[model samples]
Target: MTLAARAPVPGRFRRPRALRSERRTLHSWLMLPVEAVARLMTITWNPVDAFFEAVFWRDAKRPGKPFHGGWNSMAGRLARAVVPRTRNGAHVVMQVTGHHLRLAYVSSARTLTGAPGAVELGWYTDLRDVTWIRDRSDVVGGNHEIGFVDGSWCSVHFVGDGWSRMPDAFPLRLSHLDAIPTAR
Candidate 1:
């Protein structure tokens, strides 16, 4: 009954097979009626400070694990424990620091957007000055098309395995890689 310890968000995973980019802690069993309408749409950032390596344990024998390279199926863990994927409306929160790559939204009824878990429509990249891509699709899903450095470009939606762990935490180029379209 003690939880605390999760790290890795400084751009390092060495992809060969990676999972989790860290500092992730999500929970929404309909967070108070979906945060009373997503806290009027949480604008983002409630972390005065953070560092989490990722972990979720539940082994009443076995079968409840996600720590590090997490990718599971057994019918997607019994259909995500009786349906609770929230269809991407689980109020996003991502942090990949070593400079910047923050996109926020967190609410424990803190009322997002001006302090207290906010980031209404935010994006701040610096993935070494952007210019990225890592597409994947089989039915139109999974992306990461940044192109910043002030040139402005965005196309995120990267779900699952984060495109096989963004070249082990950024270092991509080979036309930025893309080959997951068995017909999409």
Candidate 2:
């Protein structure tokens, strides 16, 4: 048989299609900007950097534990705004001081700052109760649900925040990407 062109036939492999399971939903799309801003903030000010400097006996801006906190979810945002919740459970930012957890929030994007984690503020509580509930369904560890001492909880699906310097920041929380699992 004669061929129109004197070139060998190419492989019949078709272009890979976007997996149906990998499709993005409206919610995911909406969260894109929020996630970007979270990451940007981390780049602007990496709390972990200062943490390590202090650990090595280097002079730091604030001589204390590194900042530990992520953006709250929509629900957390509301509770953070509420006086009761803000005092007890809604913390977008926190610092582990000598005997208590100092919670703080930025002036903007207070509702959803970064990956969410909730801690119920109480008169007698320490970092021992800093709870963490990994999202087993999420193999990538992008989602984590913070369990409250009172049995309430909230989930956050953020990529992660840049707030962890050591492998095990008391409370045993995940770094999302920074923390690597040990191979047993």
Candidate 3:
């Protein structure tokens, strides 16, 4: 079946049957090692994230501010130092659904950077595609379904060590964007 034609399996986080099965098997095999590494990374990074959040990222719970000279700001510098960087510029679009958030990157936008035209962009819809999502008081980590406008979809897991530098970093990136509504 084509991507859009496929239905999500019934669950909190739905995924394609074939992909789910493959992931299940792979997760089973790698559980121990993956867990070990994840635990180690979390142990090492969570404290740093907390410190940074306490100092530079105090506004992490507020809606994100747009990326204006973010790199020059202390929060932006901390975000760059700790959070993983994407090659595409930082103009992300965010949509908050019930219990879920959808994010997309504006790879080309003249308004964002005063650059002309569009660049070839890659979309990430899954957990792996996003580095972090900061909610009030807590940082979430889990797998979620991600789909692109082109009808491509995948399941992505959150990186164990990822954390956001500002509460509003995500919302700010999405200020000018709209979420694509999905049928229940």
Top TM-score prediction, candidate number: 2
Relative to the unseen true structure, what is the C-alpha lDDT of residue 106 in candidate 3, on a scale of 0 to 100? 38
In the predicted model 1, the residue pairs found to clash are 6-52, 6-53, 7-52, 7-53, 43-118, 43-119, 43-120, 44-118, 44-119
lDDT of each: 0.34, 0.35, 0.32
Mark the regions of model 2 whose C-alpha exceeds 4 Å error after superposition.
1-91, 109-126, 133-142, 157-167, 170-184
- lDDT string for model 1 (1-184, tens) is 0001111111112211111121222444445577677766754354432112112322432322212221122212211221122222324444557776554433322333544532242334465754444432332344343333333333344444454465345544323345312211
- What is the number of residue pairs that collide in model 1? 9
lDDT of 2 by residue, 50-168 (tens): 67775864534433211122224222322232222121122234345655443343221223456333333222235444454333223323334433333333343322364322123
Which 10-residue window of candidate 3 scores lowest in summed lDDT? 14-23
Question: Order of all candidates by lDDT, from best down to worst?
Answer: 2, 1, 3
Report the alpha-carbon TM-score of model 1 versus the true structure: 0.23
For model 1 the local lDDT of residue 19 reads 16
Task: Itemize residue pairs with steric clashes in candidate 3.
Answer: 60-166, 60-167, 61-167, 63-168, 64-168, 64-169, 125-146, 127-156
What are the per-residue Cα lDDT tens digits for candidate 3 across 1-184?
A: 0111122222312211111111223334556687678878867457888888778866655343322222323222222322222322233333344333444333322433566423222222333223332232221233323332232323223332342333233322221133422322
- Estimated TM-score for each candidate: 0.23, 0.28, 0.20
Lowest lDDT block of 10, candidate 2: 1-10
